[model samples]
Target: MSVSDFLAFTKKNKNISPKIRLYLIDKDKHYFINAGTLKNGFSPKLTIANNRDSVLSAFSKMAFLFDELIRLRIVGHSNESDSSELLYLLNLVPINRKIRTFLDWKVFGPEFTRDMSRLFEVRNDTVHCISLDEVTYHPKSKVSLSSMSGFKKFRTDFQKAWKTLLEIYVTEQEKLDFKKLSMG
Candidate 1:
């Protein structure tokens, strides 16, 4: 099916959570996934807080999306080039090193994995602390606004980076025809 058709189908499923819905819609048109309908009684509540629970939840969601992309074959994995190590390189840099094992190297690359790791670091900083010392309001004017604190900056940056990465994944997907793959 076409990408738009897949997105339309996804939107029609009433069981999907609003957050996942927003995430799918916000993604670039190319990287859309046919997630199918959720089973009954599935509900995810995202509680906003400055705690490990909140951070972990967000990270988990991000990781899930990355895995889904790999499953869709939108990206390719890195080859070990050496079977002795049994090591696989990822197509995307991961926010956590642990995700490398989630898929074969042919689906996720090392560069992508590194970028993901950086994104996770930024996300973590945003979710855990608040400080007045790190943000500057006016870049050209060199006028620092006391009102914009570190937490505020982190939140803003995190959202932008998250959305951008989603878009990048989608755009990459558009270039490949998953139907050609035996698994797809």
Candidate 2:
């Protein structure tokens, strides 16, 4: 079964909450999983890590999925050596311009666009493992299990960002479906 179909099955049969399904099994599961996985077919799984590392990995995965969508749409291909480079290029254009023209971003408002931009920056920093004042490190460079205030804040922000992205994607799909119906 396709990943989306598998996810839908899980959502329906496993008693997983809709909130959990949306976060862990995105509607675009097939695209995201295929684009983000390595040759070994291993994709990042959200596990029980310290809050900071967990949030960082979650945000990075979110950003990567969005980048993969953009790459497919704009470049008409998915074999790019790196996705971060594509995101950096896309971010060079004004956020307003992007929100006006892109397939997904066209449905976003100014506030959503601004938040997404900020989230992208955070994703970049996190993926690079840049040391942040808010992140307390263990002696072996592992994330400290200790609770951190910034990690809490980041988790909240990541939820907001992912929600916004999912909403925009759904909006775009609705528009396409309506167009198809109208034409038929």
TM-score, every prediction: 0.42, 0.45
* Total backbone clashes of candidate 2, pairs 3 or more residues apart or in separate chains: 0
Off by over 4 Å in 2: 1-53, 71-105, 128-147, 175-184
lDDT of 1 by residue, 1-184 (tens): 4445544554464443222211232222322222323332212323334444554566666665555455434223212232112223333444465445432443445654554555466445545546323323322233222343534443454455456546554665565432332122
> For candidate 1, what is the total of clashing residue pairs?
22
| Candidate 2 local distance difference test against the native | 0.45
Model 2: how far residue 149 lies from native, Å = 2.6
Question: Which ten-residue region of model 1 has the weakest summed lDDT?
Answer: 78-87
Per-residue C-alpha lDDT of model 2 across residues 35-129, encoded as one tens digit per residue = 32311211333332444466576755565545444554554322344444666787676443454455354556666666666555554555566
Error of 2 at 40 (Å): 16
Candidate 2 Cα deviation (angstroms), residue 26: 8.0
How big is the positional error of residue 19 in model 2, measured in Å on the Cα after superposition?
32
Candidate 2 residue pairs in clash (backbone atoms < 3 Å)? none
